[model samples]
Target: MLLNNRIKAFVELGKFLKQFKSTGYEKVNTVLYNDDFFDEMILKINTAEHHNGWFTKENVVFAIEQWADALSEKNLKEWLSSYQLDTIPCKTIGIVMAGNIPLVGFHDFLCVLISGCKVLVKQSSNDDQLLPFLTSYLVSIAPELNESITFTKENFKDFDAIIATGSNNTARYFEYYFGNVPNIIRKNRNSVAILTGTETREELEALGEDIFRYYGLGCRNVSKLMVPQQYNFDSFFEAIYPFNIIINGNKYANNYDYNKAVYLMSNYKLLENGFLMLKEDKSYSSPIATLFYETYTSKETLLTTLEKDEEKIQCIVGNNITPTNIDFGTTQKPKLTDYADGIDIIQFLSKIK
Candidate 1:
């Protein structure tokens, strides 16, 4: 399919996705697919928990709405314009997707297809349903994509290049297996917030969205906090109190209860607001229901430390910390160009032999 055709297909798919969100799922005739297919999609979204407990309807819908906003004509054109789109020899790119959050690997799948290449996807068993269902919608809108997209459960072979997302441990395995090919292997990275204690309640509340959204399962979620030594948690706790509803989910409550108990038993100091727990630690990857915090003695020293450990950070969210940092509440809603691990996927694909 032509590049413009591919963009149009996704734009249509975005419109189809916009109909499904936390508010509820509604089928509009704007999509090319019939009601039966749309109904099946609704069923899948509703029952996604059976496949993976984290794929709750609310989280899935939030993901869909975000993608719908990102796949607009303006966003697509602007993002693609930054790259050289001249067609390369259409190679098959194998993608091993991560399932931490809903549609976490969709961007890679979209990138390979838009670069005029076929994508062979090996989806994490945790997230097998949503992407394939969306892919089916894309095929219906543009049948040409039927040839371009493949989801495999078997061991990967025949693909020329690969993109894989996993933990640091699996990354070693990915390197061992796909090392010969031009590839992008991603590992775990967590976002952190640098707070100066001067942020307004609204800003801190927005930061809560970055923290609590998707139940902190995404790489973009803020898992750590950097604050002044004597920083007070009163405003932070009050601002984020609205997100307390997250504890209503049994799975999340279980995690909160377990982690809280573990911390108390270990004699660790904790700051809790009944729902979320804040603990003083230096780790970037905090457990679910808990956030690790560190007191930064000085901005200069913290910057030096972060500069040295850039590889471990996915996003640095703050106000006036640096122009490069993402604004609060916006980490989870990444644009198409916000490549994971800071790797330019299209550039890598374009250079693939």
Candidate 2:
């Protein structure tokens, strides 16, 4: 299929997704294949939590809304404008997807197909349902794309390159197995926020979205905070209070209770506001319902530390804190060009031999 054809199909998929959003689902009569897909998609979104407890209906809807906004013709063209998609030689690309959040691995799947390569996907069983259904919708829109997408339960074979996302442990195995091929193997990386004690309450509340979205499971979630020395937590707690309803969910409440109990039993000093816990730590990865924070004496020293540990960080959220800093509340709403771990998948695929 031509690149334009693929873009048109994805735009249709986006339109189909636009019907289902956080506000509500509204069926558009003009959307292609809705008679076959529209109602089933709603069922999947509503019952996603049955497969994975973290896949709440609200979060799943939020994810769909984000993708609906992202796959616009304008956005797709802008993201692909710099790439020579037609010139890239066709090869079968293997994708090992992580199921940390709903549709977390869809970007890699989109890139492989858009670059004119066949994709062999091994989806994490935790998130296996939604993507296949969406891919089916895409295929229904563009029958030619049916040949380009494959989902597998067994080992991948007959692939020229690989893209794998997992923890640090699985990364070692990915490097061992796919080491000879052109591959992008991503490991554990966390996002952090830098506070200068000048952020408005709105910005701080927005930061709560970054922290609490996906229940803090995504690599882009701000799991840690870097605040100025003696920076007070009063404002931060007050701004994030609106999100306290997150604790009402049984799974989240269980995690919060368990973590809090463990901390108290261990005699750890904590700053908590009923639902969320704030701890003083240096680690980038924090547990559920907890946000780790560290105080920095100087901006220069903090930048130096972040630079030194760049590979361990996925995003740095703040206002002009760094050249690449993402604004607050937008970490989960990544653009297509915002490639994970700062590695461009298009450039990598274009050069694959």
Candidate 3:
């Protein structure tokens, strides 16, 4: 299929996705193939938690909503505008998806197809439902794509290159196994926030969205904080109080209770609201229901530390703290060009032999 035709198909898919959002689902008769795929989409979104406890209905719908906004014709064109799509060579790309959050690997899937290459996906068993069904919808919109997408459980073979996301250990395995081929192997990375003691209450509240969304499972979620010395926690706690309802989820509550109990038993000092715990630590990756924070005496020292550990960080959220820092609460709402791990998949694919 021509690149424009592929883009049009995804634009249609985005319109179809727009009907299912966090607020509610609204059927749009103009959307193609809704009669056949709409109800099933609802069913999948509703039951996603049964397959993976973390895939709650609200979180799934929110993810869908983000994708709906991202796949617009204007956004897609702008994202791809710099690339010379016609000059790119076509090859079968193997993608090993991580299922920590809903549709986490969809970007890689979209990139391969949009660049006019075939995709072979090995989906994490934890998140295997939604993407395949969506692929069916895309195929209906553009039958030519039927030959371009494939999902598999068996070992990948006959693919020209690989893109894999996993923990540090699995990344090593990927490097060893897919070493001979062109590949983009990703390891564990977490996002953090830098608080200068001058942020508005609104910005702090927005930071709560970054922390609580997806129950803090995504790489983009802020798992840690960098605050100035002796920064007060009272305003921060008050701003984030609205999100305390997250503890009502049994799995989340269980984690909170268990982690809190363990900390208390170990005689660890903690700062906590009723629902969330704050701990003093130097790590970027914090456990569930907890946010690790460290105090920095100077901005220059902190920036040097962040630059030294750049690969371990996915995003740095703050008000102009860094040239590329994301705004508070927008970590989960990544643009198409905000490539993961700061590696551009389009550029990588363009040079595949």
Query: What are the root-mean-square deviations of the candidates from the true structure over C-alphas?
Result: 1.2, 0.8, 0.8
Q: Give the TM-score of candidate 2.
A: 0.99
TM-score of each: 0.97, 0.99, 0.99
lDDT of 2 by residue, 1-353 (tens): 89999999999999999999888889999999899999999999989999999999999999999999999999999999998888899999999999999999999999999888999999998999899999999999999999889899999899999999999999999999999999999999999999999999999999999999999999999999999999999999999999999999888899999999999999999999988999999989999999999999898999998999899999999999899998999999999999999999999998887
What order do candidates take by lDDT, descending? 3, 2, 1
* Cα lDDT computed for each candidate against the true fold: 0.91, 0.95, 0.96
Worst 10 residues of 1 by lDDT: 29-38
Most lDDT-accurate candidate: 3
Off by more than 4 A, model 2: none
**Residue 19 displacement in candidate 3 (angstroms):** 0.6
Estimate the overall C-alpha local distance difference test score of candidate 2: 0.95
lDDT of 3 at 92: 99
Model 1 spans > 4 angstroms off: none
Candidate 3 collision pairs: none
User: What is the RMSD, in Å, between candidate 3 and the native fold over all Cα?
Assistant: 0.8
